[model samples]
Structure formats: structure tokens, C-alpha cells
Target: MNKKRIPLPWTNVYGLARTLVALGTAGTLAASSAETLFRPVATIGDYPSCNSTTAASLFCLSPDDYSHLTWLKWLCVAALLVIASGWRPRITALPHAYINYSVFSGIAIADGGDQIALILSTLFVLPALGDRRRWHWEQPQEQTPETRATRLLALIGISGLITLRLQMVVVYLQAAVAKLPHAEWQDGTAMWYWGSNLDFGPAPWLDTVVGPVITSALGVALMTWLPLVIEGSLVVSPLLPQWLRWWAMGAGLLFHLSIALMMGLWSFALAMAGGIMVLCLPLGSTIRLRADEDVATVDTSPSQEAEPPDPDRSAPSVEQPQPSR
Candidate 1:
């Protein structure tokens, strides 16, 4: 096929995606930790950690020690703020990633959202480090050695983003796959059981309001099959139409929103939504090289010809004065 392929603004696309994931991580971290500030370890007891004498090597201080850990938590919060502000990401990104890692390693109980934030925070920093250029939204450029080098670096950054994006798709697909062996999912009655369970279901008042509708056979089937199909379809996003891809991503966003509202899995929902932001990126522009025939046609076109001068509109040329010897 003699199809002409256009170049994409990979660096800028990575930059835009990184900005969103960073900001989303920041928000998730802040929201998740907000309650901890009001209810300190002193009041709620220490977070379970492996801080015994033998495990002392794992962490410097006792797991319960709030002295340094509290300060570290605040530091992470500050770093996240700086990153979200779009201040020099090269500097702040490392610290933000480190803090997120520390939250999981230093603490005993880390939410699934923490893992999501940590993964994104770490991956984004690589692109930020490699990207020495500013983000731009402008006309595509002609290829040059310098442009090629820039694109190469951009490819490196984009590779990481692509890895993360594909990883999310795999995770969702795996979840659906795993459920295939379960009778509830196969029978389309899983949502009914989930909604009926008091421990994991909606609150008492909410259950009373929405219980009957959600627990019905049709409701259960719809809820179960919709997510399975939606998540499974994401794997083939590139093959889908552009508008359909967007709609899929948007549906994923709403799915997470519903999870947060009904299931109270806010962190997981936000984290998943953050990853979907990558798929939601607008298509980058590609440079379309003109064919030789098109170029020749353009060159010969009437628009390329100079207009004939009008005698009345033309200015008279001045005669040169001759110098006498």
C-alpha cells in the first residue's frame, strides 16, 4: 500500500497525558489521606506494619512512630501539589513518585488507589525527565535530524504511557475473564448478590431506595454484561471508530463514577478513570507529504502565476542620470 502516513506530536501528547494523570493522582492522594489528618494514629491506633526488631531493617523507625512518618506524609502532599501545578515536573516528579512509593512501603494498609497513583506517578516522571522541550500545539514540522531526535525521545515517553494504558486494558480484561468461571457472572445474577449483600452493598437507606430495581434479573444481567462488554471492548480501541473510542472511554469514566457513588470504591474508580484519560487523548496530527504529481499541479496552477501589471496602477520607473566624464 502506498498510503502516506502523517507524523504525530508524540512529545506533546505525552506531556498532556502526563499532566492529567499527575493532577488526578494528586487529587486521589489528597482525598484518600484527608481523613487520616483528622483521625491521627494516636486516636485511631497505629497502621499495622512490619516494624519489629528483625523487620527494623525494613524501616528505620517503628511502624507506629508518627514522628517522622507524619512529616513525610506532609512532604508527599506538597510534592503532589507542585506536580499538579505543572511547575517544573523534572524536579517535582521524582519526589512525587518517591512519596507515593513510600506511602505503600512505609504504611501497612494501602488502598488499591495508592497502587494506581504510584504506578502513574512513577511512569510519568520518565517522560518528564527526557523531555527538555516545551509542549506546543502548532503546525507539523518538516523532518530534520533534530526533529527526529525529538521524536525518538518522545517515542520513549509515549512507550511508557502506552505500557500503562495497555496494562489497564489487560487488567480489566482479566477481571472479566476471571469471572467467566463463576456461575453468578455466567448466569448474569452476580449484580443481584452484590447488591443484596449488606456488608458490600449500598447503605441501608440507599438499598431501600434502589434495592428492588437493582436486584431484579434484568437489572442484574444488564449490570453484569455491560461492564464485561465495555471492558472487553477497550482492548480493541484502536480498531474502533474514533467517535466510538471516545464514547467507550467516556463510558468507562461514568462506570467508575457509578462505582464510587454506589460501591464507595472511590480510589479504585478515580485511578481507573485516570488511566482511561490516556485513551481519551485527541488524535495527534500527522504531516501529509504532497505527492510529486500534486506538487507539479500546484506549481503550475493559476494561483502560482504572478498577476499582469496594470498601466494605471503601476508606478513609473525613474530614469538613471548619466555622469559627465
Candidate 2:
């Protein structure tokens, strides 16, 4: 009995990571646009047309950027999100693809590192990304010419993902560079300033226990060096001992969280943190980990192998279970 051993590079892991980047790019764009369209009113007096000008205003003083919703964008975003996750229909997935396309194009036109990566990836990369629709058809019971073509398309999707990863790497390096010249970053004082800012949410009182100077000093080194460690180490990320990468990723997540909190870049933090997780975790394990997490079983084991299949090639046909939210 010959059980075909597909190489790790060709497995479902890359599929998940790439999908996340695409999905995330789409999400980030959608959210940022929404915020732009529906930002908060400067003061309560500005809400005359918004609601009755009464003291006991039933509505939220500053609803989660509510005034920005248009039926069209919402509908389109809904369609895209569904398409990004749908299992049985490519048509449903079209909106997600279109949004991804738009994002990539927009990013490219902007010429910044993030946008450049976005444009390049969307144009040359995402066509091979797969969902259940592609994979289900390739199974033994369902294999057909149509299925094979879809699988080939999935390959294209994986190619886009490769560019997407390259894109993410560029962002990591660029951000690290941005923080390089600041004396505060070198001394950790910049992080302390960031931590106390209101945009990052209220500063926690607990920080008083550790003198601000000490905290700031530690923050400066962390702020300056963390990205270097993560981005530079990426060459060996999937190759180094799994524990080492995981440790690095966890630290990266913490750093991103601090960025989100101190600098008020929450969405950016989340997306970057998610990206860090995507890059650091073995490409082949996402679907399994997702599935296991859903069923309330957690796998804590580490993979010793360093070479994860390049999701850029094999990612498209892997199945998606349920959308995370």
C-alpha cells in the first residue's frame, strides 16, 4: 500500500497562511476605509442631525464609528468576507478577490513598502488561493477535469501568497528602519511616551510600580531591537527549532500589542501580530490547528522540520472550515 507523502511545502499549511494575509489585507482596507468614511464627530454639539439634542441621548456619545456605513460598501464587504471563506462557490468568493485586487492595486499605486507589496502580491500572487470548492472536487470520490483545473488555479493563488509574504517581510524591515534614528527608541523613552498616550487607550496604573525611567529604558531597547530580531531571524524562522520561532513570535505579538496600546495602532497591531503568527508558525499546521482549536483540543507539540512547504504554490486548494469572525 503506497501512501503518497506530499512534501510539506505542498501541504495545506501554506494555504492557510496565504489565505489569512489575503483575507487580512482585505479586512484592513475595508476597516480603514470605513473609519475614514465614518469618523467620530468632534463634540456632542455637532450631532444635531445625528439624533435629538437631549441630555439623555439614548445613542452612544461616540458609537464605534457608526455614521460611516453605506449600504453598498457594507453589502460589498459582506460579499467579500463570505467569498474569502466560502467553501462551495467561486462566485461567492469573487467579492473577496475583487477587494484583494483593489487593495493590491491601491497599495502598489501608493509606492510605500506595504502598498507595493500589496499591489505586487494581488496582481501576481492570489489567483491560486483555494477553498473547499477547489479541494472537495479533487478528492478521490469527486476528482474531475474541472477539479484539476481548479487545483491549477489554486497554484496561482499560492504564487500571489509568496509575494504577499515577501511583502510582509518588507513591512517588518521598513518599520524597524523607521524606529532606528530616534534617540528615544534607542533609550526606550519613546515606548514610555507611547504607553502614556490616550490614543493607545488609558495608561495602566500598574506601570507606577516600575519607575517610568526603568520602564522606558527597557521599552526603548525592546522597541528598537524586537523587529530586527524578528525580521532578521525570518531567514531561519521556519527552519530554526520550533520552540525558538514560537518564542520569537510570542515576543513579537507582545511587541505589536504594545504598539497597538501605546501608539493606538490596534488594527495594525492585530494584523501585524497575525502576520507574525502566520510567518512563524509552520505552514502546514494552520488547518489542523484551526480544526483542533474548534473541537476544543489543543496540540502543543512542535515540528522539528524546518522546511515548510512554500504556501505560495500549494495554498489554494486547502480547505477552509469556518470564518474566524
Per TM-score, the best of the predicted structures is 1
Per-model TM-score on C-alpha atoms: 0.68, 0.56
Candidate 1 structure lDDT? 0.56
Error of 2 at 113 (Å): 12
Q: What is the C-alpha RMSD, rounded to one decimal, of candidate 2?
A: 11.0
lDDT of 1 by residue, 1-325 (tens): 3322222333344444445555555555465453453233555454533444323322234334555555555655676666555556566667767766656554544667667777877777755664444332222233324455556655565567667777777777787799899998898988888877766688776777658767677877998888888787676675664446666777888888877767777766766776776654433322123366456221100111012222222111211111211
Give the alpha-carbon lDDT of every model. 0.56, 0.44
Candidate 2 residue runs with Cα over 4 Å from true position: 1-69, 84-94, 100-155, 196-216, 219-224, 235-241, 289-325
Residue pairs in candidate 1 whose N, alpha carbon or C atoms collide under 3 angstroms: none
| Cα lDDT, model 2, residue 203 | 48
How far in Å is the alpha carbon of 217 misplaced in model 2? 3.6
| Model 2 residue 321 lDDT score | 24
lDDT: which candidate is best?
1
